[model samples]
Target: MSSRLSSRRTRAGAVLSAALVLGSMLVGTALSTQASAAPAPDVGIAATTFADEFNGPAGTPVDGSKWNHEIGDNVNNHERQYSTNRTSNASLDGQGNLVITARRENPGNYNCWYGRCEYTSARLNTIGKFSQTYGRFETRLKMSHGQGMWPAFWMMGTTGGTWPNNGEIDIMENVGFEPNTVHGTIHGPGYSGSGGIGAAYTGPRFADGFHTFTLDWSPNLLIWYVDGQEYQRRTPADLGGRTWVFNDRPFFIILNLAVGGYWPGDPNASTPFPNNLTVDYVRVTNTPGGGGGGGGQITGLAGKCVDVAGASNANGTPVQIYDCNGSNAQRWTRSGNQLQALGKCLDAAGGGTANGTLVQLWDCNGSGAQQWAISGANDIVNIQANKCLDVTGNNSANGTRLQIWECTGGANQKWNAAV
Candidate 1:
C-alpha cells in the first residue's frame, strides 16, 4: 500500500465489491467462528534478518530506530482515521505487543477527504530502517474488527518508484465485514488496484485471537501461509506476461488499522471505538542461498567451484566448473534474483530453455533468463528454463562448462552455494 493517493483506492473498491458479492451468497448462513492460538514458527528456519518484538513499558512509543510513524490522514484510501504519532494511537502494551488503536475522537479535528476526520489511528512502517528482497517474512497478530474497520500487515517496494510499478505485497489484509477471512494480494503494473492478483483464506474470526501470517519469497515465486497452512502461491507465469517487478528490489513493512475506507465503507452505530490491532512480532529471515549483495563460492560436482571462464566480465563468457581456486571468477554474489560473478549474471545462453543450454555470464537485464533459484535441495535452477545448472558431461575437470538440463537428481546438478 502507498502513502499517497494512488491505485490502492481502486483496489479497496474491488475488495469491497467482492466482499459484497460473497456476503450476498452467504446471506442468512452462519460462519463457523472459533478462537485459534498462533502456532510456533518452524524450527528449521531460524536465521533472523530483522525483527521487532515490541517489548517495552506500557504506553511507550515504538522504537524510533525500528519504526516510523506516518502521521496524516490517509487520503489515498479515503480512510476516515487521522493517523497520529501519539502513544494513545500506537503503543507497547508492556507484554511484548504493539497495539495500534483506532478511536472515534480526533483530538486535532484533523481534516480528511470527507471533511473533519471522525476517527484516529496509527500507521507504522520500516521504510528507511529496514528492507529486504527475498526472504521469509511473517507476523503474529490479532486484528481489530467492526464494520468499516480495515487492518493490514503488508510491504511495498523501496525503489521510490510509482505505485504498482514499485509493487506491493499484502501479506495479510482484513476488512471488518469479512470477520472470518483475510486476503493476500500482489499489485503491479497491468494487474494492480482492483485488478490485483490475490486469494482469500476463510477461517475462525481473526479478531478472536492471534494468528501467524507469512510470505515466503524467492526468485520468480511467492507463497503465502496462514498459521503455517499454505493457501496460495504465485509465479511469473501467473502474471499473464506482465512484468514481475518484485524480484528486482527490496520491500519494507507497513502496519496500520484503518477506519472507514473504500473497502469497508463507513462505520455504523454498532462499530466499536478504541479497538486495537495487536501485533506480537514481525520477523524476516533470509531464504538459504538467496540473500543479496554478498559474494561466496558456489561449489558443485566433485567439490569444484562454479567459475567464469577467464574471469571475464564480457557477455557470453562461459560459466564453468574449475579446481577450487579462490578467485573473483569463483565468487558469486546474489542480487535480487540474479546470481552474479565478475559483475555479470549467470545466464542461460541466448535465453534458451532447452536441455544442454550452455550457461554463461551476461549483463543483468532483469529478464527471466537471468533469474535463478537455489532450492533447499541444493539444485540451482534457472527460473525461466525450469532447468538445473549442470556439469557438462558429468565432468568435474577444470574448465568443464556448465549447462541447463532436466533435473536428474544427479550430483552434477547439486550445488553447495555460499550466497
Candidate 2:
C-alpha cells in the first residue's frame, strides 16, 4: 500500500446525526460487528517466501532521528478534523514501544507543515530517512476505539510526493467496529485508497493487546504475514505496474491511528476518545549476494530439494532451477522455506553429478536419500549423503557429473543465478 485519506458544521452535523441515528438504529448490529462489510484485497494471493526472524529498531520511537510528525488530509481521506500534534499525536514509552494518540481538541494553533488544525490524533513516519528497500518488516500493535478510528501499520516509497503513484503497502489496518480483524493492503497504479489491494484476518480484538503483523518482501513478491503465516501476495503486475515499486526504490514505515474518514464513516458518540496505536517492535532482514546466487533462507516441500551434504553449485553443466511447481519432484514442505529437493535437485557432489548418473526427478516419498538443500548464496548440499552435488570428476563435460560428493568449496560450489 502506498500513501493514503471527512465532513461538516452545526446544522449539517444535526442532519448528519438524525439521518445516521435512524441509519444506525436500523443497522446497529452491522455497525457493531462490520466483519462482512469490510472490502477484499486486490490479487487475493499470498507469498511463496517469508522471514524466519526480523531486525529493526526497538525499545522506543526514535524521535527526529527516525520520523517526523504530520497532520491529516495530506493524502485526502476527507477528514474535517485536523490531525494535530500534542502529547496525543505521538510519543515513545522508553519500554520499546510507541504511542500515537488522537484527541478531540480545540484546533492546533501552532504552525504545522500540513493540514488546518482541528481535533484528532497524530501521524508519524519513517520517510526521507530510515527507509528500507526490502526485508522482513513487522510490528505488534493495539488500536483504539471510535466509530471513526482507523489505525494502521503501512509503508510508502522513498521518492516522496503524490499518493498511490509512488506505491504503498498496508501491513495492518483496523477500523473501529471490527477490532478483532486486521487488514493487509497495497496501493499503486490501478489500485488506490479504498480501491487498493487488501485482505483481512480475524483475530482477538486488537484493543486487547499487541499482536504481530508482518510483510516479507523480495524481488518478485510481497507477502502479508499474520503472526508468521502468509495470507496475501502482490506482484508488480497485480499492482498494475512495470517496476516492482516495493523492490525498486527505498520505502519508509508509517505508524498512525486516524479518526473517522469517508471509508470508516465517522466517529460516533459511543466511540472512545484518546485510543492508542501501540507498537511493540519493527524488524527487518536481508538476503545474501544481492539478488543473485540465491540464499534468502527459504525452505521448500518436505525433501523436495534435500539429498544431504550435496555439492554447492560447482557442477559444470548449469543446473536448471524451476519454480517449485508442486510436481512430484518439486514439492518441498517445511515450517518455513528450508528446502530438500527430490533427488538432490540433482547436481554432482562437490559440483559433480556424474555426467551419465541419470538426473531424473522423483516423488516426495520422504526418503532422506532424496533430500537436499541450498543454504546461502553458496553451498548447495545434500544432508542425507553428507556430500556436495558435484560435476562428475570436475570434468566440465556438457553431459557429465550430476552426482554427489564431499564439500571442497571449489568452483563447482559457486552458483550462477541471482536470488
Candidate 3:
C-alpha cells in the first residue's frame, strides 16, 4: 500500500487569490428545472438517517446545509488541478444530479507543478455540518472519462488528531487510468497513504453508467460493496498491529474531482477537456442489526446483560454476565460480524477455535475468531470456532465471564440482542 501514496500533501488554499479572479466574473445563473423524486434504498436495511437525492431543480447550487466547498489548489497528492469554489466546477445538472466537472482551462495565475495550472475542479465535504459514528454510507455516481481525472467519495474522522491519526475511509476512489476498477481503503496512524489497508473491485467500466459504492462500518469492521455486492472487508486484525481508531469517533463525507495527482499521473493530450463526475445521490443509514450512534443492550440467560468487564476501553477486556442495568458498558452495537461495547469490539481471545475459548472485548481487527453469526435458533455462534456464546455454567450468576462452547438448545445459550 505504501507504494501508492503521494509524496506531497496537497494543501487547498495556496492559489486561492489567483483562482478567485477567474471565478469572480463567472457567476452563472441556476437552471430552473423540475424537481425529481428521491430513489428508494436497498431492501431490509435500517431507515435512512440522512440523504441527498440531488432531485432539486437543475442548475442550482448544492444545499449549503449539507456541504461546504473545499477550494484552492495549495497542495496534496501532487495533483495539477486548481480547486475552486465556482458553480461551473460543481453544480446541479438540470436532470437530478450533482456534477463536479474537471476542466482543462487555466484559472488565473495558479500554477501546477509543470507550469501554469492546466486544470480546474472542485471538492466538497460535510465537515462541521454532519457526521455519523457507525452506519451504512453510500453514494451513486458515474466516473468522469479522461486520463488524469480522479474522482472519489470518501470520509475522514471528525475527531481531532492528524490525517492518519484521525483515520480516513475511502469509500470509493477511481482514476481514469483504472477505469474499470475502484478502490476502498482505511488509513490510520501506522497504515496511511500508500500503507493504507484496503482492496480494489474490478468489473465493467464505472464510467459506463451510474453505480453505487457502499461502506458498512461498525465497531471494528468496514465492509465495502459495489452495487450491493460486497467485495472487501477489513478490521483491526488487518491493521498489522496498528491501533483501531474508527470506533472512537464520528466521520464526515467528502466528494471531489481531481486532476493530475501522483496516483493518476498528469493528464495527456489525449485526455478530454471538461469531464464530469456525475452523482445521483448519497445516503446514510443505521444497519438493521447494528445500533450505531444510538446503541442498545443484549438480554440473555435469566435476562442478565452482556456487559463489558469494568467498562474498560482497553483491548482484551473481559465480557461478562451481570444483572440487567442499562449503562453504556452494556450497550451493544452490531455491524457486519462485529459486536461492540464501550468503544471496543467483542472478540474471541487469541483467535482460538477451541471450545472454552473466552469471549472478551478487544480493539477491532479483522480476525475470524471475532466473527459471529446468529443462528435460526437464536444461538450466537462464533464462525471461526463454530462455538456458541455460552455462560460458564448453567448458573445465572453475576460476574460470570462468557465463553464459547458446543451449541446446545440450552436456556443459557439463548440471547435477545437488541441490535
lDDT of 1 by residue, 103-139 (tens): 9997887898789888999988887899999887877
12-35, model 3: which lDDT tens digit per residue?
421000111111111112111112
Which stretches of candidate 1 lie above 4 Å from their native place? 1-6, 9-46, 288-419
Which TM-score value belongs to model 1? 0.61
Each prediction's number of clashing residue pairs: 0, 98, 13
**Which residue pairs overlap in candidate 1's backbone?**
none
TM-score of 3: 0.61
C-alpha TM-score for every candidate: 0.61, 0.53, 0.61
Q: What do the candidate models score in CA lDDT, each in turn?
A: 0.76, 0.49, 0.72
Clashes of 3: 13
lDDT of 2 by residue, 1-419 (tens): 22243111111100000111111111222111112221111111113222211122433334565566664443345543455556546666654457777776655453322345445676767656566777666665666766777888787776644555567788888878786787888776556755677788896777875566667677767776554345677776675544445666677777777666666766788976666777655544443121221122222222122222222222122232233332322222221112323211232213222222222222112234334555454554555555544444444433332344455555543333222
Residue 407 C-alpha lDDT in model 3: 71
Candidate 2, residue 197: Cα displacement in angstroms equals 1.8
